[model samples]
Target: MHSLSKLFLTFVGFVGLSLASPGGGEDLPAVCDFAALRARWPKESCEALTSIQAGLPDLLRRVRPYTQTYVLVLLDRPDGVPRAWDDPVLSRLRVGLLADTPAETIAARYKFAQVVPYPLSPAGACALFADLHRGKIDAGLVWAPLAGYFVAVTDVENRLQALPVPQPLPPLEWPKSAWEGASASDSDLFRCADRIQGVLESYGVAPAELLTANVEESSVIPDQPPPEDLAAARVGEALYYRYCDRCHGTQAVLGRRGLELRQRFLQLSYPEFIRAIWEGRPGRGMPAYRGLLDKTQIEALYQYLRALTLGKIAPRQSTD
Candidate 1:
């Protein structure tokens, strides 16, 4: 149980601290498990949990005296928290700091130990929790909400019930996008727990609750809406990257191709723009993204491209 707790903490840290790329599509910060560990163990018996939020490998030394054999699945940000690695100019960028924990650290912990870092997407995360519920792994750490979703759907027997781990540190709030608009209420949090509990119930595994929940207290960036200027630019950038970056480099598309197509495209009414997207020009191989994007997204893209035409959204000069 101690070993599992330590592993869970390490897993959460890796997910929270990754540095993302700037030009990537909309990305979410991965929600990390931050439930308390001590509540499960008799208060007097358990050692204090090492800080997972520290975002360092050396910190694992506190747990080195424990067992061995760890498979670390590096998590993508799901909570949409602002990462230190995020760029001020462009959003949605992340990269892992420590690819895998030091081999020496693993060796020191157990006579026989192995550490492998498997990067998993959100889809992969769901699949993982499914396996965990089935007793595929000795122990697993995953998003609580997802753990809940899996349990509810699988209807696994209660070999393992979801346990609520209290966080040693103060509670934190992940960004709004974390739950895809799900209100962050006690009910929502418990719903996540219920999902996991359901799965554990089905599997007949007595769910062990951790003592800590390592949630963020506040976002690195405030919750205020983007400035109008910045919002306009973001919309423009998103559209340019998604639709316009194919034929020309972003800068070239914005600075040159945009100029070339200005009058031609402006003459296009909204319906024409929609048509261009829905029905591709066969010769050009410009396929339709009608279903891929919503009306707001499409309009944002339009505003961005239009800004380019007016010379209001030129690409930054290349440092290279």
Candidate 2:
């Protein structure tokens, strides 16, 4: 290992004395996992999950699923929580990390032993869990939630075990627009997990839990609702917070200026917006919400977007 990388891991371990591991149940956007990992169903039903289309270029179709395998590695540490990497428990073992994220996410701070250069959807994660349990690989790294979800769905014997990655997770994303005209090599854009879909069919299954969602609507932003749009906007605001906030962001501030809901609502007529929702822009990692949210609910979402675009509600930006 590089001398500086060794020094840094030692430093981060000191910080770990106070830091808590990330929550396994927190909601994540589609890029992390949707029907396959984390997804928020509406008050009534969850729309069926969309499959990666066979016709689209293989890279684009697998983009979202591949996104999760990148960033950090979660290893099985039975003795105690693994802190960065200097612990005697990991001294000789070649630790694993994924490359689905930007190099700087991990490379800037600490060094990892090996980065498996491939991507997987939820199904691939299942195969990996099987591999780990069967001892095909030792000292492996995996997306934390993927491990959690796999255990939840499978792992009947309770044989699988893991220690959460203790550091803060980097902001992992692969919004399709970000790749709109990409010229990067195949390896640069993604390849976060082992390539192993042929052995399992979990790729075709859904991993989302269908719960009876409970909600009454309200804006996460400043909402001085106009009298006529009041009730509808209230419901829409609730929906936005429940489903859209994770990606669109707090108070509707999306990743970039042009992609913000406030901006998109300005140019899109009601029909265009709804159509976009009905037939999601898959290239961008958004899943079609048609079955999950009904017309009435969608119409309410539009009311909220309308209020947002016209400045009826105040906008909020992400602080983290």
Candidate 3:
């Protein structure tokens, strides 16, 4: 009986050792080189191993490595409808857009064949959230904060999923000759064009169609305040100090975590500026102040920002 017990213990020890070993007791390469692994295993198996190695910490190196890339994601609906970009029934998908995001920009990026625009305003975002709760639309392109807002307001967890746009490989860098034409070879130009075309293809876009597509240029109307409205500017200055100073800093120099409002106001059209202020970029830490501040107050804020940009109002130095 003692000999049998000793044999059982020996068997358990062997099993444990086998389980801990790479490939379950099979002798495998010590180095986690994907190129080497691919020669021995199936492509998929090799890729899985590569991904696993990429995720695990390199104890010897004592540093983490990660790739930075952005992908166009398809938002999934909570309703019983299929959650895929290529669903035949979902060929005509309505996209929700913030005022800042031009419809042309979305078309250029995603290359959606059939897009019905549903622009989301400050109030409209909440209404859209309600519509999403009832599963009205197939999907909505929303930022992280807006998605969070929807879930918070509607109390739905499985409402949306952001799936990354798949790419077989990283996009090729555009050649310098592609931009500067003074010293460009025909072959170099063709190669750069081909690379760009490949990138568009990865996004499911037809390169030929884009070649002939005409995108309308948005008109910009400069914000010009009358000399008498200096009083309004003063009022705007007070409002800016109270609400915007913390983020925008003095004279909109972009204080801690603050975007350069003066620069943005100068570049963007009047309507765009108003929309940005009213709607705010929820995903980018800017809160919607539609109800918090009235139209007149918002206009005042805009005036002050514009004045600063136009050199009418001098920038105040930070006290800190």
Candidate 4:
């Protein structure tokens, strides 16, 4: 307060949009707004990550202290580990690194070493040691993982070397926090934020360490709520009203007991349900949904119907 007052600097602030910002209705996480978000991004796959901005940075400052978000490390070519940070043996060697990352900042203070700032897209990862093959840098100063992946693949020829991270671990930007509360819910945003901070605490800041050529985590199946949860039945509920309600009755009420989804679900397995939707019986006046919806959407719709059938959730918003 005194420093800013001495210089007479006025502060102006701006707020960024957040998915978790609550105001309207339903009181659910934005991630649960599946149909709306998917419609907004027709071409992209839907994930809980609304944006890289996860909105934690500023919101957290008011609630708690920020933890170490990254690690800074020393990487040397197989020639061997240099004795010290001020090691005279490292003088005059080009240090290949990405600019402005923890590694670049760490390299700037080197007692005797050369630094090569590899030009790259800030949003993308670069194999830091890939430059060593260009015969330019004698040693590489970079964050882990980026170098780890490249080294994992390229070092098969025994051309590179690993200098173990010093005792305990490499110098990190801050101490890492462990993921805390997995069972937390959207009803308590702060507790949810606490869990988010834990899992993401050690995520790297440098592009190299942050991203890798090989995917560390992956998923083909779309994320969904548990079968017992009402959300799991969302797609089917929507589709039921749009296509099946008129003939089968809203909520598939027993107006036509033979057509009740609950009964049909007991008779037909999930594969049979998928097959019927994919290849609807033309003679029976049922239209195939394949032309109307993608496989994932159709699958979601089926899951929703199954939930309705099992009495896991009462039909919601059913109408004539």
lDDT of 4 by residue, 202-277 (tens): 1112122222223212133334432444564676576565555544667665433235656765676555666566
Cα deviation in Å at residue 212, candidate 1? Answer: 42
CA lDDT, every prediction?
Answer: 0.34, 0.40, 0.40, 0.39
Task: Name the runs in model 4 displaced over 4 angstroms.
Answer: 1-83, 120-127, 164-320
Runs of candidate 1 exceeding 4 Å displacement: 1-230, 252-260, 318-320
Q: Which candidate has the highest TM-score of all?
A: 2
RMSD of each: 21.6, 19.9, 24.3, 21.1
TM-score of each: 0.26, 0.34, 0.31, 0.28
lDDT of 1 at 158: 24
**Model 3 misplaced regions, further than 4 Å:** 1-228
Per-residue error (Å), model 2, residue 291: 0.9
Q: Which of the predicted structures, 2 or 4, would earn the higher TM-score when compared with the native?
A: 2
